[model samples]
Target: MTPQYMNISYHDLLKATSGFSSENVIGTGGFGVVYKGIMAVEGIITSVAIKVLNLEQRGASRSFLSECETLRSVRHRNLIKVLSCCSSIDHRGNDFKAVVFEYMPNGSLEEWLHPKESMNSQPFESLSIMQRLNIAIDVAAALGYLHEHGPVPVVHCDLKPSNILLDNEMIAHVGDFGLARFLIRQANISSPSMTSASGIKGSIGYIPPEYGFGSQASTEGDIYSYGILLLETFTGVSPTDERFTDVSSLHSHVKMAFPSRVLDVVDSKMFLERQCPGTKTVCAPKSAHDCLVSVLQCGIQCSKESPRERGTMKQVVRELDSARMLLLR
Candidate 1:
């Protein structure tokens, strides 16, 4: 079914977000802040993620409209669905602007992989090997859809664990479309090899090397980011973690360790159920180990330094799907 668009009022947003209270805030971005909100339409209370523009900024209003235009034209299961938006004056006569999204109860993959002390009991233990594989597949599928099947091809620009949110059922959804860009066809002309002029828009460590050299942002750039995310998901460690310091970076470290079959670097949770009577080395089930190896290989392929050498999102999805099927079997 086609999505229906509607303009919501600021008062409605205040009610939904509980007056934009500090407690309702879930995340923050460069252009706006996200808050948890609820709205009752047709007698049903629906939870949402409300991203309100920072009105005080000089040019934030323009960016807000651009984001709304980009989001309103696209729809996919992996992308966050926009319930509605508000860009009007509030009761205090202050101008306001905000976008509403479906709420993701499980927070983000980042939080689950690297929980803070304040939220230590946040249920990462519930994710089995199969479940992680499923989430990875969902993310890859979403990227594939965006790159190949959207109304216009789009580059997610920022593909990180923190932007990948999981719902109550653990289904992964790629959020934070503020940095997304639509690809344009330019008469099949050859593009530059680098994109340094853009000046690094993505998170540190996840940014591709070519991006620093002035290579134009392409599907390949997103592939590189996805590769980093995949490795983080499996290792349960950030790419910039101390363990990766011995080597220059996570990519190089993984390449070096791949030859040694060093799968032990993967998440400790995988070995939880198989620890021996009194040993630190826990044996992973053969199926789980194989799945981990496959996932690592996919990450490596997607992260190849040469953009031309990287696998497309479609291929990544296929490989992840196969790994998931194997683990489930």
Candidate 2:
């Protein structure tokens, strides 16, 4: 069902965010800054995340329109919901534009994976094996819906840990649709169109190899990005780590130590937390070890250098669910 959009004004948003105060700033990105605000929804005042676009930046206005269009067309619990939009002039007489969304209180998956001292006020806690598994499934399901089940198949174009927000229950919600594309299906073929004419649409490291060679945005590209995100979540390492210099990409790095040596690169905190108490051996529980291996295998399969070799989001979701069941039993 389509959500009812609240008609808001520049003054209303200004009041909601305290004139876009520095204290309200929650996140910063290429196109704009996200501010936490409170706005009345159906007569109840609720917190929201407002993405204020930097109109001065090239392509920023276009991004705002693209995100609005894409969000209006798609609806999924795993995908971020757009509450309202503002496209009026600011008090300064300059153009103002923003997209209001449901605020994710738990923050982003990136914050949990790589916490910085200044990033969060609360004590840092590592995500458990179960939490990570669930998050992965949530994201894969979202992408699968976007790629296959939605009324209009949309290409997220940008899929990364930073873009994955966690709600109060830690359920993952994929955000940042500024680079999204609606694929035009012709028979069995998806139309070809570059996300950006001059450069790549997504962040470095998350972008698929085919995109670099001028391949158009496709579901396969999103799958490739998802694969990298899964690998990073397990390993607790960034794809752009300095060690990944030269021919060594995240996929290759994880591939080299896969299966038998998988434990070597796995997140130490996660492994230790799952390790049996007072145990001296390097091994984890047999079920857990098997589960980790299977999960990593999915990541490996999804992040293949060749798009054709990568698994679909549906396949990834199925494999992850199987791993989750293995851990449960």
TM-score for each model: 0.89, 0.94
Which residue pairs in model 2 clash with each other?
none
Highest TM-score: which candidate? 2
Q: Which ten residues in a row have the lowest lDDT in candidate 2?
A: 191-200
Model 2, backbone clash pairs (residues 3+ apart or across chains), number: 0
Clashes per candidate, residues 3 or more apart or on different chains: 5, 0
lDDT of each: 0.77, 0.89
> Which digits, one per residue and each the tens of the lDDT, describe model 1 over residues 1-69?
456765578878888878899888888767778898888744578888888998887546755775676
State the local distance difference test value for candidate 2: 0.89
| Residue ranges of candidate 1 with Cα displaced over 4 Å | 57-63, 91-94, 117-126, 189-200, 243-247
